[model samples]
Target chain A: MTTTAPARPAAGRSRRPSGRRAARWPAWRAFLLLTLPMVAGLFVFKYVAIGWGFLLSFNDARGTIALGDWNGLDNYRRLLGDPAFTRSLVTILLFTLFIVPVTFALSLGLAVLVNRLRRGRALFRTTFFIPAAVSYVVGALVWKMSLFSGTPSGVANSLAYLLGHDDAIGWVAAVDPPLYWIVLVTVRLWLQTGFYMILFLAGIQQIPAQLYEAARVDGAESEGRLFRHITWPMLRNTSVAVVLLLIINAFQAFDEFYNILASNLSGLGRADGRTPLIYLFQTALGEQNYGAGSAGAFVVTMLIVVFTLLQGRFAGFGRTAEEEG
Target chain B: MRRRHLGSYVAVIVFAVPFLLPFYLLIRNALMSKRELGSLDWHWWPETISFQGFADAFGNDAVPLAHALWNSALIATISAPLSTLLASMAGYALARIPVAASKPVFFFIIATMMVPGAATFIPTFVVVGSLGGVNTLWGLIVPGLFSAFAVLLFRGFYLRFPRELEDAGRVDGLGHLGLYGRLALPNSGALFASLGILSFIEHWNAFLWPLVIGQDPEFWTVQVALSTNLNQQAVNLPALFAGALVAILPLVALFLIAQRWIVRGVLLTGIKG
Candidate 1:
C-alpha cells in the first residue's frame, strides 16, 4: 500500500530511531491532542465539580462561596422530611406520566399518518416541524401571554368560551391548587412533539412495507390488524428509546417552566418546581449556595445514572458490540 | 376509498391544529398594531394588519439584535464545522480503530449525555469566568462547541460506511488524515450537514447558559434579549411577538434550507445512540 516502502529504510524503521514503536506513539498523541479540551472541560465542569457539589450537601453554611463544616447527612435528612420536596417529586412524576404517553402516541400517530401519505408528505412534515424550530423562550412567551391567558383577550380563554366554558382561567398562575403544572406540561408538549414525531417517522420508514401488503391481502382489517400485528411490534425499540428519553427530559424540564411560570410565584419554582436540576440551580446560582447546588446535582446525577441503567437493561440502549455483530 | 382519504384529511387537519395554532396566533398578533391587538376575538387573520409592531421592535433597546444575530451566525458557522470535524475524527477512531479502550471510550462519552447541564452550570461558569470568557462570545461557544452526542451520530454513520474505501485510499499512499479528509468526508456531507444544523439550532436557541455567561449586554444572544424584553413590566405583546418572529426566523430558514436532512436526522433517531 505504501509507495515509499523500503527506498532508504522500511517505513516503520524510518519513523522510529532504533524502533521502540512508532505507529502507537503518533496515534495516541494525536488522539490525546484532539480530546484534550473536551476532556478538561468535562472533568472540571462536569464530574469533579459535581463531586464537590455532592460533598457540600452534607455541610452547614460555610464561607459564603466555599464549603462549610460537615453536618453529616442533615441535608439529606431535611430533604427527606420536607413536604415541599415530596410534593415536587409527586408533581413531576404525575407530569411525566401524563406527558409521555400523550406525546408518544400523538407523535407516533403523526408519523404513521404522514408516512402513509403518498403525496405532500414534505408539506406535512414541514408544517408539523415548525414548532421545533421556534425558540423555547418565544414559545413559552406565546403560551403565557396569549394561549392560556386568563383574560377574554387571551386566545385559550376565547376558545374555551367558544367551547362553552363559562370562566376565563388563570392557567399559568394556577400554582397553589397546582394547575400550573398542567400549563407546564402543555408548553413542553407544544415545543417537543414535533421533534419526537420526526423520530417516530424515522422508525416507521425503516419498517418494511411488505408486511403491511401481506396483511391487507390476507384479509386483516386496517386499524385492528395494523395495531395488533404490525405497528405495535415494529415500533417497540424506538418506543422504548423515546420513552426513556422523555422521562429523563421531563425531569430536566426547566426553560419553559422558568420562562413562562417563573414569574407566577415570583421566581419561586426555582424553589418549588424543584426538579433536582432546578433545585441545584436555585441552590447554586439563585441562592449562591454552590456547594448545596453541587450536592443536589450529584444526587440528580445518581438518579440519572440509575434510570439510564434501567433503560439500558430494558431497552438495550446503545446496542452492545455483541448485538452489533 | 374516497371516504378514507377524506377521513385522513380530517384527522390531519384536526390533529395538526394544536401544533399550528400557537404559531398562527404568534404571526397574527405580530402583524396587529397594539391597539387592535386587544380585541378578544383572535382568529387566523387580522382585518387590518400593520408593521407598527415590527417598527417598534426596531426601536427597542433590548440588546442590539443585529449584533446578537451576527454573533449567533459567527458562532454557528465556526462551532458547527469545527465540532463536525472534531466529532468526525473521534468517530473515525471509534468506528475504525480496534483499540482496547475504544468501546469504553464510546460508552464514557455517551454516559455524559445523562449529566444534566444544570449540575455543570456553576462550575462551568467559574471555569469560563476564570478563562476571561464571561461576557464574551467564547463563553457561549466553549461549553457547547463539542458535543459527545454528535460524535455518536457520526460514529454510527461512519461505522456503516464501507471500510474498503478507506483501504483503497490507504493503498494509494494516503495518510490517515488524507483518508479522513478526502475519502470519508465528501461522502458524509448529509450526516455532517445534519449534525451541523442540529448544533447550530441548539446554540442559536441556547438560553440559560448564554444568559448566565453573557453578562455583557453587548454579547447577549437574541433569545436572551427576547426573554429579558418580554419579562419587563409593560409587556408589549405586539412588539414582543415581532421580536419573537424575528428571533425564530433564522431557524425556520435553516430548517427549510436543510429540510431533507432535518427530516432524515429526525426519522433516523438522529439523536439516539
Candidate 2:
C-alpha cells in the first residue's frame, strides 16, 4: 500500500504535456474547483481553529470563547496548578500505559490464533470484528448497565452470585482499590482489541507462505518456532503501526470513559478514570472556562505528539520505501 | 490433529464470548420487561418477547428519542455522501493533477490526521459557534465533511487507478473534469461505497460533537439522546437498552451488508500506515 504511492504516473505525465496545451485551463480549473471547498473548510475549521485555540490558551477568556482578553500564560499556569487537570493527565497516562501493551499482545495473539485456523476462520473473524462496528457509547452502556451494573440482576453480579460472592459490586463507582479499572479496561479491550487483531491478521496474511514452508523444511517443527523466526519478524511494520494507532486511540479515550463514568446522574467520577478529554470537556463546556480548557487541550496535544514522535522515531514510521528497502 | 482443531475451536469460542455476550444481553434485556430484567434470576433468553421497552423509548417525554433518531439518520445520510464526494475530489486532484502544490497539500491534510481531536475540540466549537452553527444541524454536518483519513484513502486508491482507463479518456478528448466525472467516478464505486459506509457509521455513532453543537433536544443525535437517557433518573433500564438497540441496529445491518468492503478498508489502512 505504501509502495504503490510513489510509483507515480510518469506515463500519465508524458501524455500530460500533449494534453497540457489543450487542457491547461481546464486542468487548473478542475483542480481548483475540486479542492477549494475541502481546502477552505480544512483551513477554517482546523488550521484557523487551532491558531485561535493557541491564542485562546493564553487568554482569560472564561464564560466566552471570544479573544482579545490577554492573560499571558495564566490559563496554562492555572491548569498546571490545579490538581484535577494534573490528575486527569496522570489517569490517562496510566490508562495508556496499561491498555497499550496488553491490547497489543492480546490482539497479536488473537490474530495468530485466528490466522492458523483451517476452518471457520471467516466466521470467527466476523464474530470478533463485528464489535469494532458497535458504537463505543452503546458498548459502554451495555457494559455498565447490563454486563457490569452494580445491581444484583446485572450479568457480572449474577456470575458473582453463582460463584458464591454475595455482594453486588459497583464496578464503576469502586475507587479505593480502583476496581473501576477492571470495568474501564475490559470495556475498552472488548471494543478495540478486535480491530487491532484484524490489523494483525492482515499483517500476518501478508507474510509469504514460502517463508513458513522453508522454516518447516529447515527442521523448525514447532509452530511456535516458525512463528518466532518468520511470522514475528515479517510483521514488524504492522506491529509498529498497530502500537502507534493503539497509543493514539488510548490517549483519545473519552467516549467509553465519559459514557460509563460521567454520562449518569452521578456526574463525572471523583478523579477515577477521568481522562484528559473528559476533564477538558467538563472545563470548557461544563464550567464555561474556555481558556483553561484550551490550555489543557494543548497540554494533552503535546503529550500525544511526544508519544507519537517517540514511537515514530523507534518505528521509523515516515521513512520512504526506498530507505526501508 | 483432531484434538488440536477441537482445542482451537474451544479457544476461539471462549475468547469470542466476551465480545458476543454484550450484544446478546443487550438484545435479550431490551426485549424483556422491567420486572424480568430486575429479577434475581437471570434469563439468558427472554421467556416472552415484549416491545414495551421499545415503545417506552420511542415515546419518552423528556428527550425526543424518535426525533434524535431522525436527526442522526438525516445527518449521517447527508454527511457521508457529501464528505466522500469532497474527499474523492481532493484526492483525485492530489493523485492525478501535476499541480506543484499537491504534495504539500496532501501532506498537510495527512498531518491533520495526527492532530489529537481534543486540540480541535474547543476551537472547532468556537468556530462553528461563530458561524451561527450552534443549535443547527449544519454545524454538525459541515466540519465533519472534511476528513483527512478519507482524503488519504481516496488518494491512495487514485494513485493506483489504472492509467490505461484515463489514457482512453484522453484519446477521446475528455478533459480532466470529464475524465474524473465520466470515467474515474463511475469506476471507483467500490471506493465510494467503502468510504461512504465508514463515514455513515462514524456520523451515526458520533456523540461529543453532536452533543456540543446540538444543545437543543430537538437536534440531539441518537448517541446524544441515549446518553441523555443514561443521565436521567426516571429513564427505564429496559427502555434505555431498547434505545441503544434502535441506535445500533442500522449500523450493524450496514456493517453486515458491507462487511467485505469495510474489512478491506481496515486492512488497507493497516498496510498503508
Candidate 3:
C-alpha cells in the first residue's frame, strides 16, 4: 500500500526503448505530454506560492502583497506576541488534541457495530455515510439554525426543556461553559464520523473471517476478546492512518467552525471558537495583512508537519514504505 | 461466524439518529413557513409543507441561490473532467513511465500535499489575481484542479496495471499517449468513475477557495453564496434553510446514486498520504 512504484520496467517492455532514436524520442515526448500539464500547474500554484509566501512572511506587507518592505522575523514575532493569534494557535491545538481521540473512538466503535450487523448493513452504512457527502456549510446551517439555535423552540433547547432544564441555553453563544464546543464538536461528529467509519469498516472487512473463527474456537468465545486480539491488532495500519488523518483534519478545521461560529462578513464572532485558519483568513483577506497571514500559515503548516512526523516516528506509519521499497 | 448481535443493532440505530438529525431538520425547516419555524409549539412536522421557503431563498437578490447553483454546476463539470484527465495522466506517468526524474517528481507532489493549502493560499491568490483570474470561474476551477492527492491516487491505480496489456499495445504500434488513451484509459472505468466522482464532489463542496476566488455574486458557487446568506444581517431563517436544502440535495442525490464509486474512492485514501 505504501510503495508500489517500480524503479524500472520489465525486461521485454518496448517502453524501455533500446538504443533506438525514434522510440526514445517518442517515449520522452509522451512522458512530458502526460505529466507536464499537472506538474507545471502544481509547480506554479503550489511550489511557487510556497516560495512567495515564505518571502512574504518576513516583510511588512500589510494592505499590500508587494515584497520590498523587509522586516525580518517581525511578522512571526508580532503573530506570536498578539494574544488573538496565539489564542487561535492554542485553540486549534486543543481542538486537534481533543477531536482526534474522540472521533477515533466513536468512528471505530461505529464501524465495529455496523460491521456486526448482518441485516441492513448497507442501510446503516448509507445512513452514516450520507453526512459525509453534505457540504459543511449546509450541515452548519442546519445545526446552527434548528438543532442548536439559541431559541427555546430549538430542538436541543426543547429537549432540555423536556428534561426539566427550563433555561433556553444559547449553545453557540455561551462562553461560560464554552458551549460552542458542543455545537462545533457535534456538527463535526455528525458530518465526519461516518466517513471514518467507512474506512474502519473496510479495514475490518479485510481481516479474514477464518481468524475470527479460529479465535472463537480457541476459547475466545466472547466478542470483546475476539475484537481485542484479532480485530484491534489487525487494524493497526488503518487505525494509525485514521488517527493521522484525523489530526491533520482537526488542525485544518475551518469550514464548520467558520460557518457555525463566524458571521462571515463580521468575521469570527467570538474569541472562544477561533481556529488558526479562521484567524489567518480574517488576517489575510479581511485585514489585508498578508504578512501576518503568510507567517501564520507557515506556522500552522509546520505544526501539521511536525505532528505528522511525530506520528510517523512513534506509530511507525511509514514502516511499510521501507518494506515495499 | 455471522452472529446476530442485538447490541450492534441497537447501537447502530442510536448512532444513526444524530447523523440523520441534521438532514431531517434541514428538510423539515426548509418546508415550514417562517412563522412555523419560529413557533414554540412542539410539532413533530411542519404545519404544512411549503415551497415559499425555497421561493424566498431563490428569490433573495443579495445571495442569488439559483444562479449560484448554476455557477457551482459549471465549475464542477469543468473542473472534474479537467482534473481527472491531468491527474490521471500525471499519476499514470509517475507509475508506468521509466523516466529518471519520476521518483523525484512523485516526492515533490506528495510533499505539496503535506503543506496545508491555506498556508500557500495567499500567494496562490496573488498569482491568480495578477493573472486576472479573480471573480472568474476559471479562478476557482483552474487552481483547485491541481490536487496532489488526486495524482497520488491515479499513480496508485496504474502501478497495479498489468504489464501484459501495455506490452500488447506496444505490439499494436501505440505510443505511450496512444496506449494511455486507447488501452489503459478505456479499461480502467472504476478508477475513472471514482476519480471523476471524487473531483466533482470536491469542487461542489469547496468553500474557502471558491469564496476567495469568486468575489462577485455572478461567480459565487453554492457554498460561497450560502455562506454569504447565512452571514447577512437579518437573515431569513426559513429561507436560509431552504437555500441549504437546495444546496445539499443535489449532492445527496448524487451520493445515493454513486455511493459505490464514492466509497471506493474514499477507501483509496488508505493507500498512502
Candidate 4:
C-alpha cells in the first residue's frame, strides 16, 4: 500500500530533501485549520464555563453571574432546604418514569405497524414524522391556546360539551389532580414519538428477512411469536439507545413546560408541573440567583450522569461493535 | 391478507388523527378573523379567509415580529453552514488522516456529547455576556456554530466512503487538497444537506438560550417573540396562532422538501455506534 519509497526517491530528493516533513505538513495544517476553532470554542464555552459554574455554585453570586463573594455550601444548602426545589426534582423523576415507558411503547408499536404495512407506508411515516419538525414552543402554544384552552370553543372543551360535560376545563391551570400532565404528556408524545418511531423503523428494517422466513417455515406462523423470537431480539441495540435518549430528553424537559405553564401573567408555574430545568431557569434568569441556579444545574446533571452510567452498565452501551459481535 | 391490511389502515388512521389535528387547527385558526375565533360556534373550515391575524402579527407594536423573524433567519443562515463546514473538515481529518493523536481527539469530541446543556447554561451566559455578546445576535449564533453531533455524522459518512476513488485520484497526480476539493466534497452532497437542514432547524427553533441571552426585542428570535405573546396581559389568540404558524412554516417546508435526507440523518445518528 505504501508507494512512498519510489515516489519519494524519484521526486523529492532534489526539490524537497525532507520528504517526510512535507508529507506531514498538509495533514497537520488541515487538522489545525479545521479543528482549532471548534476545539477553542468548546474549551471556553463548555469546559471552562462548566468549571466556573461548579465554583459559582458554592459562592453567593446573585443579581450577577460574576464570582466574588464566597459563601461555602450556602447555595446547595438553600436549594436542598427549599421544598419547591425538592418538589421540582420529584416532579421530574415522576415525569421521567411515566413518559419514558409510554413514549418507548408507543413509538415502537407505531414503528412495528408502519414497517409491517405493504402499502402507503411512506404516507403514514411522513404524516407521523412531520410533527417532529415542529418546534417545541410552537407545539406547546398550539396545544395551550387552541386545543386545551379553557374556552367553550376550544377543541377539548367542545369535545367535552359534546360528551355532556358542559364546563370548559382549565386543563393547564388545574393542579389538584394535575390534569396538566395530560397536556404535557400528549404534546411531547406528538412531537417526539415520530422521531423514535423512525429510529425503530430503521432498526426493524435492519433485521434479516431470512430469519423471519425461517421462523415461518419452522411453524412459528403467528406474528406475535415471530416478533418475540426474532424482531424483539434484533432491535436490542436500538431499544437501548432509544431508552437512553428518552431518559435524557425527559430530564431536560424545559421548552414545552415553560411555554405551556410559565407563560401566564399570574406567575411562573412553580406550584405544579415544574421540572428541574424550569426551576433552574427561574432561579438563574428570572430571579438572577446564579449560585442556586448553578447548584441546581449540577444536581440535575449528576442525576442524569448516574442514570446514564446505570443504563450503560445494564445495556452494555459502551461496548465496541466487535465485542458485541 | 385483505383483513390484515384493513386492520392496519384502521390502526394507522386512528393513530394519525391526534398528530394531524393540531396542524389542521393551526391553519384553520390562522385563517380565521378575531371575531370568528372568539365565536362560540366552531367553524371546522373558515367561512372567510381573512389575513387580519397575520397582519396584526406582522404589525405587532410591543414585539417586533418582522425583525425577530429576520434575526432568526440571519442567525440560522450564518450558523448552520459555518458549523457544518467546520464539522465536516474535522470529520474528514479524523476519518482519513493517520495521525496517532486523532483517535484521542475524536474520543474527546464525542465525550462532550454527554454533557447536558443545563450544566453549561449559566457559565455560557456569563462568558457570552463578558464578551459583549449579550442582547446581540452573534451571542446566540457564535456559541452554537459547532456541533459534536454533526462531527460524528460526518465522520460516519467519510469512514464508509470508498477509498478507491481517492486512490484513483492520487494515481492521476491529484494531491490531498485537490482530492478533497474535487472528489470527496462533491460526492458528499447528501451528507451536507442533511447536516445543514438539521442545524438550520435546530437554530431556528431554539428557545431557552435565546430567551436567556436576547433581552432586547431587537435581537429576539421568532421563538422568543412568540413566547412573549403568551405571557402578555392582553393575549390576542388569533395573532398568537398566526405567530405560531409563521414560526413553523419554514421548518415544515424544509422537512417536506428534504424528507429523505432528514429521515436518513435521523436513522444514521440512532443506528451508528
Winning candidate number (TM-score): 3
lDDT of 3 by residue, B114-200 (tens): 777765677788678767898987788889888888888888788889989998998998888888999888887898888798789
Full-model lDDT for every candidate? 0.71, 0.84, 0.84, 0.83
lDDT of 2 by residue, A277-312 (tens): 888888888888888888888888899999999998
DockQ of each: 0.38, 0.63, 0.66, 0.50
**In model 4, what is the error at residue A120, expressed in angstroms?**
1.2
Q: Say which docking band candidate 2 falls in.
A: medium
- Residue B147, candidate 2: Cα error in Å is 1.5
Number of clashes in every candidate structure? 4, 0, 0, 0
Candidate 1: segments with Cα more than 4 A from true spot: A1-20, A55-74, A78-83, A175-178, A263-274, A311-325, B40-44, B62-64, B97-108, B129-132, B268-271
RMSD of 3: 2.5
Where model 3 places Cα greater than 4 Å from the true spot, the runs are A1-6, A9-18, A263-268, A317-325, B1-4
Cα error, candidate 1, residue A133 (Å): 0.8
Write one digit per residue (lDDT tens) for candidate 4, span A136-252.
898988889889988888899899989999877998888877888999998999999999999999888878788899999999998899988888888888888899989988999
Per-prediction TM-score to the true structure, in the order listed: 0.87, 0.94, 0.95, 0.93
Colliding residue pairs in candidate 3: none
